[model samples]
Target chain A: MAQLFWDDVEIGMEIPPYKKAVTLMELNRYAGANEEYVLIHMDRDYSQKVARLPDVIVMGNLKYAYLSNMMINWIGEEGTLKRLSAQYRGMDIPGPALSTEPTMICKGKVTNKYIQDGDHCIECEVWTETNEGQVTTPGSAIAILPARS
Target chain B: MAQESLITDEVRAAIGVETVSPPELVEMKAIKDYARAINWPDPPNPLHVDEEYAKKTRFGGIIAPWCFYTTLGRSAPRQRVPLPPARVGMNGGNDYEYFLPIRPGDMITTTSKIVDIVEREGRAGKLIITTSERTFTNQNGEVVGIAHGTGLSQY
Candidate 1:
């Protein structure tokens, strides 16, 4: 991975989109890793019958992780992730109900750049959208990148 | 007739009450599992799973992914605002600030508190939004990260 320097960033620059096709097994794995065993996320029967949801829903925290990964991949090892925030505005279902192809698209746009307390800071507006173009999670992040100097 | 307010006096009093969790040791397996969970179909980032490669990077050793803290302190009891029962509850969102890298073998302690609770009339009828804050500290007493979470309950 190449080191991303503050000099390389410009306002309006967009981070390459990170895409994934969410599955039931993937959601189960996330439940094991995070210990979030909420029935709405694991058991389709419980999710649909008990919870009255359409199907097992993806964990909001997992979506948060996706957004973080997008920024981490963009910043590289030298850059530091300072802050990340998101609001879960919509719900996403995994597997066949959605589509066979990758549906979750994670994206970010650099919104601002400046020096703050000796740190070269870059702020970005980040979000995840379904293939249908509905923004499920919307958020922002701040990262510090090394300076060329 | 007006709907009854969910923010009772008892619920208001529960705000700012804090729960402190016992320290738990971070493990390499947990980190790797988390990395794999999020990066399914595609390989996880080497910085999170590849120890040999991470040794040469600035982190010196493999570090957990940015949101790994969400997995910590799960067994411990949490403080919840005393709101009236509602039909359904769901995760609203989260805000996280990372101050340090969490590495394997590090001990993490978490303190959580409900900061605010508000009621609103929604399309469904009534909604309760609970905002909470959690602080994560390492064994060295350094604050590694802080998370602000919002949970919504609808009636």
Candidate 2:
């Protein structure tokens, strides 16, 4: 994989749009893998009865993992993923295309560029939006990019 | 120290020490299983790549799927014997800071330290929030990533 060179990146650059469709099977697998059997992540009946939700919801960690991979894939290895901060804003319930009223959207906007301790880097304001356009996981990250020679 | 208190020296000591586990190797099949299970679109394509496609795509190789850390984070749960009044707590939520992208062929180990503790009063009862920092290192001992997550407990 070609490391993302700083020379190729543009200020205010926008990464390619990426989408991930979460499903029941995926939620089950995640829960099973983590041994997180909380009713909210599965068992629609329990979630509705205990949590008072319309249906079982996806785990917040699932979204965090999905968005992190997408950003890493976009940046490549030349750059390092410095940080990711997110909020568990909405519940992802199972359905057809656009299950929840708002589809989860992850976006990145370049905020700053500079070098620290001899390494060139860029700061980005990253966020996730619901299909309804509600910002859910609002976060930021700093990546070390190869210096343009 | 009162049995009901969550801030005992023993608990504090457990939080202070850092723990590093042996590296675990994750193969393409295990990763693909995660994708298939999550039903994440663009799965097999992102798993492996061809020359022609590699030219067009920015990501040159099979990118590691996200949440790989969740697996690494599960290396081992802190053993806690349930006392009559103080039972082990449930995970409330995690606030993670991802430092680097985990790639294929990379052997990652999680090194963690409990950073902080906060006690609070909730409608249900008292709760404790424990924050931990888990740094992922590559085979070369290079710190590739770091994650700080919070574990919550209520009794």
Candidate 3:
């Protein structure tokens, strides 16, 4: 397979989206890794009574990390993940809900030119939406792909 | 100090102070677990699982997936600006940039500085918005990543 070169990519291209269904155990592990001992994420009772949340919630950064793979997978081997910024708009609850799966879409030309002869920076608007199709985490990124001449 | 009050003069005064966490070696176990926790298993994400397979990728060895830097750190204490005393601080947003891959055995250290902090009125009443910038470097002193985060605080 040919590496994703600058010549191959075009504006308005869409990197196929990916989805992940979050779970409670995943939330707990994420908390432990970041040393984020916040009760709203780990303790259900505290989340419900004190924090006034529905249930244990997933960490925002965890969502960022989980969703990052979509961009990583899209850029392929020779490309670099230049930048990604996430604006966490909605609160995500862990557990079985029809609304659990979050999807990331890498869409259309944020920049007109993919840098030539060296690294071509493919920029795009990246986003994650809830099952209801409401945008949750809206972000952008600049992915650099090498010119395979 | 009252909940409705503006940010303390101290918080404003302490801006630009830099703090460095102790060095920590990136671990493959932690990387694997992070991938699994995200429900990213098998097929495509083999670099986090099969060591031999990772040896073949451009990364050259087992590596934590992208955005793993968020969870990279140790319990080492660092003295930095203190937040205005508030009962709750929520995750506001994150702006991250990657320079290089974090591989197993790479000693990762972060130097962070308080860039901005301000108080504003919101529907909830008063909000203290604090922003910080973290620069991550590997043992070779090569910059691996940078992350800027904004957090909101309320009483």
Candidate 4:
């Protein structure tokens, strides 16, 4: 893990994109581990008839984790994940892949840079949109970057 | 209001109560194993063994993935299983506010408080979103991080 000097990053810098395709196997594993017996996350018939979902969908936390994972990996070791905020906007259903029809989109652009009480920080406008151009989760993050040597 | 019924006097008494505990030292190996378990691509754990890279990390030398909370294990209080299972269940989302750096060799304990519970009508049925605010503290009692998450249960 290489340290990213504050000077190396600039405003408008775009964090690389990331994609996630939820699967039944992954969904079942999460449900089993968390002991969440919500039919919509595992039972396809229940989700379709009861929840009106296209199919059983991925859990919201896992989606958020995917977004968080993207940002953390972009920040590297010298950077610290300070804050992450997200709103659940839509669902990611199983079948034909959630983001595959077009693409599973995870993109972020640096929006602000500053020092808060001695902590070097950068704020970003981040989001994940579905294949059809629907914004699934709108989010933002703050990271502490190491000072340039 | 539907929320009023859910927040009975008995439940109201449980609000705003803070539970504290020591931090659990998250291991790098555990983080890597979790990613492997999920089979997620581009494992987030930066493969590094040099002390220099580890020393710069607030998490001591161990580089933990961002979603370490999922990796941090805690048993959920038992709940009665309602007959005819709920039709929907979802994780609303999470808001993480970082305070202190989580260092390696540090034992982390989480303090979780039930913040709010609201009932709403979804396409499926009566849905409940229970929000909980959890704070993580190191062994020295230093506040490390705070997270807010919601669990959606539909009946």
Which one is best on lDDT? 1
lDDT of 4 by residue, B80-123 (tens): 22223556566777888877655456677888787876667766
lDDT of 1: 0.89
lDDT of 4 by residue, A5-41 (tens): 6777789999888776656765665555444556778
| lDDT score at residue A24, model 4, on the 0-100 scale | 71
Which runs in model 3 stand beyond 4 Å of their true positions? A1-3, A97-112, B1-4, B40-44, B74-84
Task: List residue ranges in candidate 4 displaced over 4 A.
Answer: A1-4, A8-12, A25-39, A49-52, A95-103, B1-5, B19-29, B37-39, B47-60, B71-73, B76-87, B100-106, B121-126
How would the docking of model 4 be graded? acceptable
Model 3 agreement with the true structure over B1-155: per-residue lDDT tens digits: 35445556766776888878889878877777766665532244777778998889888888787778777544435544556466556788888888888888888888887788888777655678888888899999999999999888765
**What lDDT score goes with residue B93 in model 1?**
96
lDDT by residue (B18-43, candidate 2, tens digit) is: 77777877565666566554434445
TM-score of each: 0.95, 0.71, 0.87, 0.77
Would you list the rank order by TM-score, best first?
Answer: 1, 3, 4, 2
User: Residue A109 lDDT in model 3?
Assistant: 36
- The digit string of per-residue lDDT tens for model 3 on A31-57 reads 766667888778889888876677776
lDDT of 2 by residue, A1-149 (tens): 56677767777988664465666766777776555677677677777785556787767777676666656777775566666665555556655543432246678777788878887878777776666676666666677777659
Q: Which one wins by DockQ: 1 or 2?
A: 1
Candidate 2 residue pairs that clash: A26-B37, A81-B99, A102-A131, A102-A132, A103-A131
CAPRI classification of candidate 3: medium
lDDT of candidate 3 at residue A119, scale 0 to 100: 67
- TM-score quality measure for candidate 1: 0.95
- The fraction of reference A/B contacts recovered in model 4 reads 0.56
Report the candidate with higher DockQ, 2 versus 3.
3
TM-score of chain B of each: 0.94, 0.74, 0.86, 0.72
